[model samples]
Target: MDGAIWASAYGCQGKAVASSAFGRPSGELQARADSPTPAGIRQRSGAEMIMGQGAVPIIVGGEVVGACGVGGGPSEDAEACAAG
Candidate 1:
């Protein structure tokens, strides 16, 4: 769940990075789109695999203390588990 841990550290949802990576296959994901390349899918999977998923930051007093990663079924299912 490295992706999930990274998510907490970055203070962003796991899906955000994945989506960005998919939406943009060339250059920085934050850059131009409408010209997605095969590299985009690779980047997305790599980031997700390396960063982790189905995880949520454990915050206390407005500070992140830890994170929880859940994986069993689909990413959505995992995310739902983490959310609860």
Candidate 2:
């Protein structure tokens, strides 16, 4: 199944980031940025793993300067399986 791209840009307080879905990232990253739900957090799995689901946090002087992310969607039971 096709997945949606979710991203976030962080700047001290943090915010959403905008990026193309063409690039493949990590689901965990994206879920944290987009959906905070249990399902969103545990989506994607295996070779069929969904793309754009990870986060990149910017740190400066032991502080979180910013962060970026990408991912979300309704695929198969991969997320459920992964969660289990």
Candidate 3:
């Protein structure tokens, strides 16, 4: 995958893993929305969610330690490679 896609995939997976750990599916969005800001400033919404099917969280001792994302091939092939 290209660097941009790789980075985006990693970021998305990280956020998802974090949300799963916290048991809040919208934790990232909620936090971004709830942040205090200047009156004239408006927080942006509708952020694109780029999820790479090949990415999976690495769990250790019942906690998510890290993640791995693979791209550049068919989604299922990438996922299978990552799974193995």
Candidate 4:
């Protein structure tokens, strides 16, 4: 599957944004407002999370601007896991 697609689908946007702002590669963020944990929803969060690997932030000019998470699911694990 596509890592970007999964990340987009699993609410990885926040993580990506945080990564970009913090200049860190490893980080966690809630996908939804009702989410119980910011890290993720646990086993019920879906294959994208249950089997997910890691999230990597995209930094620009010493600041996080976005992120690219890899692994943890078929869609995002095509190549390798990008840990944040």
Quote each prediction's TM-score.
Answer: 0.40, 0.24, 0.44, 0.36
Ordered list by lDDT, greatest first:
3, 1, 4, 2
lDDT of 1 by residue, 17-72 (tens): 43333432111332333235544554656644223345555566866555555554
RMSD to truth, every model: 10.4, 13.7, 8.5, 8.0
Q: State the displacement of the C-alpha of residue 73, model 2, in Å, after optimal TM-score superposition.
A: 11
The lDDT per prediction is: 0.44, 0.31, 0.44, 0.43
| lDDT at residue 59 of model 2 (Cα atoms) | 46
Runs in model 2 with CA error above 4 Å?
1-52, 71-84
* Cα RMSD for predicted model 1: 10.4
Give the per-residue lDDT of model 3 (tens digit) for 1-84: 444454545545544443343333322334443345411122232333323344455667978666554555565655555557
Clash count, predicted structure 3: 0
Relative to the true structure, candidate 4 reaches a TM of 0.36
Model 1 lDDT-worst window of ten: 24-33
Off by over 4 Å in 4: 2-8, 27-53, 71-84
For residues 1-84, could you state the per-residue lDDT of candidate 2 as single tens digits?
134333312211121121112222234344444454423433431122223334344446866544444224332232332223
* lDDT for position 29 in model 2: 41
Candidate 4 lDDT tens digits, 1-84 = 343444454544433443443345433332332355533443344423322224566656866666675443543342235541
After superposition, the stretches of candidate 1 with alpha carbons farther than 4 Å from their true spots are: 1-49
